[model samples]
Target: MKYALGPILYYWPKKQVEEFYQLAKASNADVIYMGETVCSKRRMLRNGQWLDLAKEVAQTGKQVVLSTMALIESPSELRNMQALVDNGDFIVEANDFSAIDLAKQAKVPFVCGPSVNIYNGSALKLLVKQGMQRWVMPVELGRDWLIRLLDECSNLGIREQFEVEVFAFGHLPLAYSARCFTAQSEGRTKDECETCCIKYPQGRPIVSQEQQRLFRLNGIQTLSNDCYDLINDQASMGGLVDVLRLSPIGIDTIEHLEAFRQQNDKDRPFPTPDTVNGYWHKLAGIRQSEDEA
Candidate 1:
């Protein structure tokens, strides 16, 4: 299956962001997604800069996709989404329904991001009619759900029309809110507060009262405390999954990408700790199934 490098969800410095993409250029990633899908205030790299980076990355023969914001709170955000849709060089990932509408109006083929609520075969068929070339399945859904959905799509004769991507690795993005949890944790309001999300590159982990890791707060996005891993499950995904997405979390992300690329080696070590494969096994998202363990 093809491997994709997902966009950086954290608010990183411009230099770090550029350096990370440079590493991606040399990695085994077949597809690369870029752009800020979280809060708009994290402008380390503006739309124009992201487009320029996309152009540069496209030269390496890897498919590049621009991702739209998951939550559009204002008209400015909507305008930005329009600009991404209008980008003629590369396809865009529609994270919100507004983005999908913009892409449809622009008559451009788009990929639906995981944030978009496309739960049924009917929704997938409708999106295909609107120029959706591919879709990243929502993280909460498991393998059984996907198999059934693909079967339904096959029966409807729309399964071959679009590709299927799964969020294979990284901390699961659980929810998004109007308020900036990162800023709130620092006793600052969302507006006046400086972009403090950069301080914690991977997000601030929130633990339960029993001292167990619960979730992570990254600006306005809430993510799972444990990284969701599916490298070992690749054998079962041969025919069902088109692409496996690995989200960029740190400098070591490229290493993990290499591991996923060379997953056939039985001696290769699994890199991240406290990983969860339960979501793929149809169990609680945070739990690691014994068989997978």
Candidate 2:
């Protein structure tokens, strides 16, 4: 299977964003997803800047897909999604229903980001008709459920029309909200907040009373406390998945990409990545199989 780099979920400076994509162009990720999937208020790179970056990245022979904001709160965001779909130079990942409609109207083959809840065989088939060529499995779904979904797709005979991608690395994006948690934590209103998220490139962590990390607070998106590692489980995806999406955290991203590549390319077994894989095994989202043992 090949690898893909998911969009940057945190708000960062414009220069850091540019430099990150430059490193991504040289990494082992087969497909690179761009644009913002989180808060649109954090616009370090505007719409024109993102499309320009998409053009530059596409020249590197890597498949680039622009991602839409998961929660489109305004007409401007809808227009942005439309522009991304009609860009003609790259594919767009439809993160919301409006994005799906935009891409369908444009008659372009779009990708369904994990945030878009595509669960069963019928849903997959319908999206395929809507010109969805790739679908990333929802982060909370396990292997058994995915196998069933694919089996149902096989029965429908449209399995080959689309590719299956899994969110295999990085902290899982659990949920999003209409309220900005970061701003609330900082005692600022969402509209007037001074873009406090930019000060936190990796997001602020939420810890329990015992001081264990429970969640990560990006502007409005709630992510998992720990990064996920599935580099060792490559063999299980042989017939099920076509691409593995590695989400971008704040640090050591290319190194993670290279490690995944090495693991996917060889059989000697690379060193373990100290992240959780509980959700993959169908246990509680945070409890690993060994944890129960």
Best model per lDDT:
1
**What's the lDDT of the predicted structure labeled candidate 1?**
0.92
lDDT of 2 by residue, 146-219 (tens): 99989999999999999999999888999999999999989999998789988777788889999999898899
Report model 1's TM-score to 2 decimal places: 0.97
Candidate 1 lDDT by residue in tens digits, 52-145: 9999999999999999999999989998999999999899999999999999999999999999888999999999999999999999998899
Clash pairs detected, candidate 1:
none
Q: List where candidate 1 sits over 4 angstroms from the true fold.
A: 265-272, 291-293
Q: Model 2 clash pairs?
A: none
Clashes of each: 0, 0
